[model samples]
Target: MMALQHRYPLALAIAASLLSGPVLAQSAIEHHVWQDKRKFEPYSRTAESITGAIRLSGNNQFATPGSKMTITFGNGKKAQLTSVGASWRQWDDVDGKKVTAEVFKVAKDPGTLLNGNTLCGKAAKYLVFHESLSFGASLLGVAVFEGSKEPKDINSPGLCGTFNYSVD
Candidate 1:
């Protein structure tokens, strides 16, 4: 009985090591690769556009995940989108001679303040936005997502840098 007790631990440890060896080896061989554009869907451009960015950590480096923004301009007259925030803010400038203006919440993502997948629950945890804009009958805008926007009811995101995507 004494000999069996000593051998049992050693035998179990050996079995465990053998069972886990392939899994551990496979994990060591797996790594992430970077690409300028996703082959599944090369960034696209149209009269409408979408854009934004968020950090995606892989290996030792962090990269911006992918996001697409579409725009509608020229004949486009109105803009509207849903917001994750409880309210939306809009600013109106009455020229350099303005004295005062209206201040209120629109209750949604008015004028495209982080809408669509940025707030949707069914999308990736990170958002990386890319925009392609043109002048004639084309769209132009920037999109950015901050992990801070994530629900506080859950544990806060631990990323150390601000996530952003801008268009110029």
Candidate 2:
């Protein structure tokens, strides 16, 4: 189970296969869910939102400058969040030298926006840091996808989950 925690970020990568399997494309993949998490009542929702990414090709690092993040609620329901930014670094296997790879992600909730397109609209800003690592499971390496964050800007979005080498 300890390895699962490290794989939290990659949750989104398998989300497609877990939901229906390898038959649809990215555009067709609008919603990613957990096989067991969705079994609960509090997780099922017709009006839900999610955002994340996985390594696809080569080693790279990504991020959004500043310690600020936001979620678009509706036309006027928006929220901002800050998490002191998250960072991770470690060594893997490199021909026997214990080579190391690193990744730094920073996300925050920027409050809520009121009058939006619908009664429930939300969005958040994220940065992906895939230094010397592939992200997309079927494509990249490191995969990190957590719940983002909520109004607290610290408690993590609604789901409070993340992914990395484990899930990847």
Runs of candidate 1 exceeding 4 Å displacement: 1-18, 26-48, 51-143, 146-168
Candidate 1 lDDT, 48-145, residue by residue in tens: 23323312122221122122222222222222212222111211111122111111111222133232322323222322222222343221122223
Instruction: Summarize candidate 2's per-residue lDDT along 1-168 as a digit string, tens digits.
Output: 677658785885577467765344544622111101111111112222222221222211222224343323223233333333333333221222222222223334333322222212333233222223334331112222243431222222432222222222
Error of 1 at 165 (Å): 15
Q: Which candidate's lDDT is highest?
A: 2
Q: In model 2, state the lDDT of residue 121.
A: 31
Q: Candidate 2 overall Cα lDDT vs. reference?
A: 0.28
How many clashes show up in model 1?
16
TM-score of each: 0.20, 0.20
